[model samples]
Every structure is written in C-alpha cells, then in structure tokens.
Target: MKRIPRETMVFLLCSTFYRLASGALLVSLTWNILNQESISYFPLALAILCSFIPAFVTPTLIRRLTRKFNGRQMSARFLLGLAILTLVAGACRYDTSALLVTNLFVWLLFLLLEASLDMWFTQVQRGLAPAQVQRLSGATTASSQAALMIGPLLAAGLTPLLGNLGFSMMLTAIFLVVAAICHSAGQPPITSNDTGSDTKAQELPLALFIPMLLVWPTLGAFNFMLPVNVMVQGWSLLELGILDASFGLGMALIGVLVIAGVSGSRLLAFLSGLLTLSAAAASAWLLLPQDLLFRCACLGLLGMAFGGARIQIRAAIAQRLDEAAVGRSVSRANALGTPVLLVVLLIQLGAIATAWALPFLMVMLSIALLMRLALQRSQPHSAAPDATPYS
Candidate 1:
C-alpha cells in the first residue's frame, strides 16, 4: 500500500478521537438508562429512533454552515458545542426524562458533527491519488472500530469514578478540544469547495447504496438475535462478551485487507457480493447448532462480510461524489436506510417475544437479507466504474 500523508493520518486520529468520545458518551448514557427499572424499551427505542430521524436535515445544516466556515472551523465549533451539551447533560443526570432528552440532543449533535467531518475528509482526499484514497478510506473505516470497543470500555471505567454524565462531559471537553486542534492542523487552507458545493460533483450510482442500506439491518439482526440466542441457551455474560469480541476480531481482520488495498478477482466479487456473503453468514448463524465456538465463528463471518461490503460501498461513493454532495448523499442514505433498519429491528423485537419463533424469525431475516442479492444481481455490474478490492 502507498504511504498515507502525515496530515491525513493526524486527521484520521482526530476523527477517531471524536468518534470514541461520542460513542463513549452515548453508550454510557444508554447503559445507565437501561439499568433503571423504571425506564421502558419504548422510550429508549424512541430516543434512538428520534436521534436518527433528524439526520435527514444534516445536509441543510452542513450547507448553511459551510457557507460561513471551513471544515476545520465547523468541526471546532461543533466539537465545542458538543462539549457544552455534555456538561448540560451532566447537570440533568438526576432526572430520568431530562437525561433521555439530553442523550437525544447529544446524539443529534454528534450526527451533525460527523456529517461535517465527512465533508472535510472528502475535500482533503481530493488531493490524493486513487490508491491513496483507498488506503485512507480503509484506515478511517478501520479506526472507526475504536468507537465500538474502546468507546464502551471508556464508558465503563469512567462511569464508576465520575458517573456517566461526568465522564462523558470530561472526555468530550478534553478529546474534542484536541480533535479541533488536530483537525485544523491536518486540513488544507479553506478551499471554495470547502465552503460551497462542488459544481462538478458527479452523480452517484444509487445501486451501490443497496449494500450500505442493507448494512444496518443485516448487522442489526446479528446484534439483536445473537444476544437473544445466547440468553435462550442460558449462556453467561462472559460468553456473550467473548462472542462479541470474536465478531470485532473478524471486522479487524477484514479492515487490514482493505487498508492494504487488496483487490478481488471478478469471479470472487460476483460470487461474494455483499448480499450473498451476508446471507450465508446469517444463515449459518441461525441454522448451525448453538455450540459456542460455532456461533462465534458465524458471528465473525458476518462481521467480516459486513465490514468488507460496507467499505466497498463507501469507496464507490467516494469515487463519485464531491464535498457537499457527498455529505448530502450520505444523509439521504441514512434518511432512507435507517427507517428500514428500524422496521427490521422492530420485527426482530416482536419475533423474540416467543421462544419457539426465535430461530424462525432469524431465518426470515436471513432470507430478507438474501432477497436483496436478487436486486443486486439485476443491476449492471458497471455500477461501480472503479473496481475496488471490496467489490
């Protein structure tokens, strides 16, 4: 793989830190709420769904902000705002309803911040060669896993000392301040494209979005079903943690290939396209005997398939779209995609209501995930003009 620019590496580090802080805060708040006997799933679900639904408006927010600010300035301002919001959330930690409300806004701010940051990254990557783009893209995606694992660990350690809100607040202020500085150091001088839409932004191939859209629900089912399966079999939390870690390991393994900028054979890309691979893994997970090792293997497979597919889709999108349009395109995807995920997750919740229906429901989900492959195949393979390793 080509050497990634130092500026890009530092920018990625900034992005990772911001992601880690946001993830830690959100997870900490949600964990506290879940432990409360008085809180119901409806409110928690609503809180999450509400946080997601507002993301459709992020494009408009980014458009207006970029008119007055560069990506670095936008990131700095938002990071500071998020830090303040976390402090406010700390003040409201004693009130259940207030805490939920605070958590919702905190997530909403994070979403907006991410959209702006992505715009910045899109602008920055424009200076790189295609191969360099691939490396940076993969590294950013791989580093993103920090938000999932390290973020949660941060929440756990901090919660005992300062409580959820306090740790979140402290981390938000500390990490985001540094994130702002790194972001400034890493970015180019404000280009017109940074402050406005690119006139020459290419039209994206929407067909590629199928995998990105399926990404959420596919993973959601995996996330939703695996725990239920573990509990039904009366497994310990340690076993569940191990299974989760195995899945994370699989994701990391795939990330390495992506970062190395490995390419796929045409035959391999065709046979192992996003939907097919995910369905195979999901099916194996649902059908195979519930041996812990087997379940772990299946989950790992699902993670690898999901991560590889997601990277492929993103690389294609990056190849097409430019600054503002990139952010808007992603916002649109989230707007449309998350609703599907919400629906799928809701169905899974209902399916798990009865013990007999667990495996059947999972089978149905695997089938649903597989059905997309038909749509995928129906589309022209030329959908991605650039043949990526992930493709």
Candidate 2:
C-alpha cells in the first residue's frame, strides 16, 4: 500500500473537526438554547447572514497571508481563531443576552476558518499526483460527512452524562486545537518542496467566474427542493432525514470508489453530476415523486453526481491557481454564489405552493450546462491528460 501523505492526513482530520463544530455542535447548541427560550429563531437566522459578512475581506486577507504562511500556517491561524471563538460561545449556552452576540462572532469565525482550510487543502492537492489527489480528497470528504453523522450521535450519548454546554464547548475547542496541531506538524520547508507560491498560480481564472455563478444555485436546488417535497407530500420528517442521508450515502459511495484509485475526466465528473441530478428529478416527478423508496434512490444518484462535481471543480481550480489565488477564487465564487442561491431559494420559498422540484432542477441544469460549455470552450484546460477521469 502506498503511504498517505502527512499533509493529506491532517487535512482529513481537520475537515472532520470542521464539520463537527460547524454542523453538529452548532446545531446542538442552538437547539439547547431554543429549548430554554433563551433565543428565538429569527436572531439565529440573522446570525447566519452576519457570518458571511467576513467574506468580503477574505480575498484580501488571504492574499496578504499567502505571502508569508504555508498552507498549514494559514489553516492553523484560522483554526486557532475558531478554537477561541468556540470557548467564548460556551458562555452563551444559556444566557439570553449573550446568545445572539456569541452566535454572530462564532459563526463568522467558523466560516472564515473554513475558507482558509479550503485554501490549505487546495494547495496540498495540487502538489500530489492526480490519482493521489483523488484518494485524499475523497477520504477527506467522507471523513467530514462522517463527522457530521457521528457528532450528533455522540452528543446525544454524552449530553445526558456530562451536560450540554460544558461538554460541547470543551470538546469542540479541544478538537479544533488538535486539528490545528496536526495541520501544523510534519511540515516540509517551503523553500525546498512547496510550490504554493508559483507565479503562474497567482492569477485567478476568468473562466471560473460565470460558471461558478451558475453552479451553486443549481447544486443547492437539491436542498431547497427536498424540504418542499416533504412538506407538500406530507412525508414524515424521519423519511426526509433518510432521504438526506441517502444523498450523503451517494457521495460517500463515490468517494470510496475514488479512494480505491478510480479515476475519470474532470469535465465528465462535473457534467455527469448535473445530468444525474436532472434525470433523477425528472424521473421522480414523472413516475414516483411521492414514493419514499424511489425518491431515496433518486436523491442518492443526485448526491453521487454532486460528489463527483465537487472533486473535479476543486481540482480544476488547484490545477491553475496557487494557495492565495485558490482562496481568492473559491471564496469569491462562494460569496457570489451565496446571494444567487439565496435568491433562488427565496423565490421558491415565497411560492411554496408552486415550487415543484422538477422544474427547478431542469432550469438550473440548463443554465449550468450552458455556462459549463462556455467556460470549457474558452479555457481548453480540462483536456490535460492527467485531468482525464475514469476511462
């Protein structure tokens, strides 16, 4: 067996920790606070919005930091910030007055930190061979999703014994600290090995912008559509949860295959995911839209496609950009995509009576395909022999 790289291993661990704190732990904390009537859902909604306020500064901050810190150093800085914020948030566990403020800062730091980790991972992946990059990124994505699943179960088992506030905060802080430590350890000297500062990598690709603008809302359609489907059909929340889990299952299944050294074209990966999603949505709407079992299958296929698209998109970016440029490009893509995603979601939400999943999927798929084709024609980059995926 080939030895896994130190940087990749650390990245997987950090990814795990990030998902736990961001997804499970925060949800747990919010649920507890809501149970106590210490805070309302509206403020929590606002907290989420405010979190992305820092996105405006990310491109500039990352560019300046990339001049000095290696990938690990950049990740460690943000992780350490997240650790501290997690500690501070413990005080808001039951306090009505502090809950809003704590949530605001904690979520803000969490997002910024996540973006930094994306930068780190992108930098690391570009250094390895294409096959190795596939395995490692797949492993990391799987580990992250696993953590989200495992964390809530762990919280359920532990909350009874140790209580919520102290246990959650302490464990989250410690977990983040460990992630930072691991990411910082086994570091290779930059002068000798790292190429994150390559001159060609400094410029963000022009092709990425329009395509990215289309990508997010299309991918995010799954999230908005599924919930509405459940509401309209009067399906059980348990079934909804299962459907969600099925999506993750699809992603993990694909990741497992990639980790086993399966390879394929980047362009195919991206397109197949969108097409699978479109086909599944079309099938579900036409045939078994209300059948829980069939719906689960469709969601699973959609997830697999999404998983493939995610891997290829990041790899494509890393193929062209250095650490800072990758950070700038991704962060910008996310920021721009977020608003369009929100708009699409809100339009759907406002017309819940008419927001069928099939139409949404078809429209987004069309836009995504057109933008994807336009970008491909302009760049001519995905044809790199190594960028080719499964034969």
lDDT of candidates 1 onward, in order: 0.59, 0.58
What is the clash tally of candidate 2? Answer: 5
Write the residue-wise lDDT of candidate 1 on 26-81 in tens digits. Answer: 65565455444333445545555566666667667776776666666677777787
Off by over 4 Å in 2: 29-47, 88-90, 94-100, 155-162, 189-207, 210-245, 261-270, 281-299, 353-391
| lDDT, candidate 1, at 164 | 56
Predicted structure with the largest TM-score when compared to the true one: 1
| Model 1 accuracy (lDDT, Cα) | 0.59
For candidate 1, the 10 contiguous residues with the lowest summed lDDT are 382-391
Residue 42 lDDT in candidate 2: 36
What TM-score does prediction 1 earn? 0.77
Q: Residue 218 of model 2: what lDDT?
A: 60
lDDT of 1 at 367: 32
lDDT tens digits, residue span 1-391, model 2: 6676776677777677766655545545454444455333333333344445555666677666666776667667666666776666665677755666666566555645655676777766766776666667677666766565455455555566777666667566765776657555776543212355555434444444455444545645454465456655766434545666666666676677667765444444445555656576556656774688887777666666556555555555565555566666666666676666566656665665545553346444543643454345445676342222221
In model 1, pairs of residues that clash are none
**How many Å off is the CA of 105 in candidate 1?**
1.4
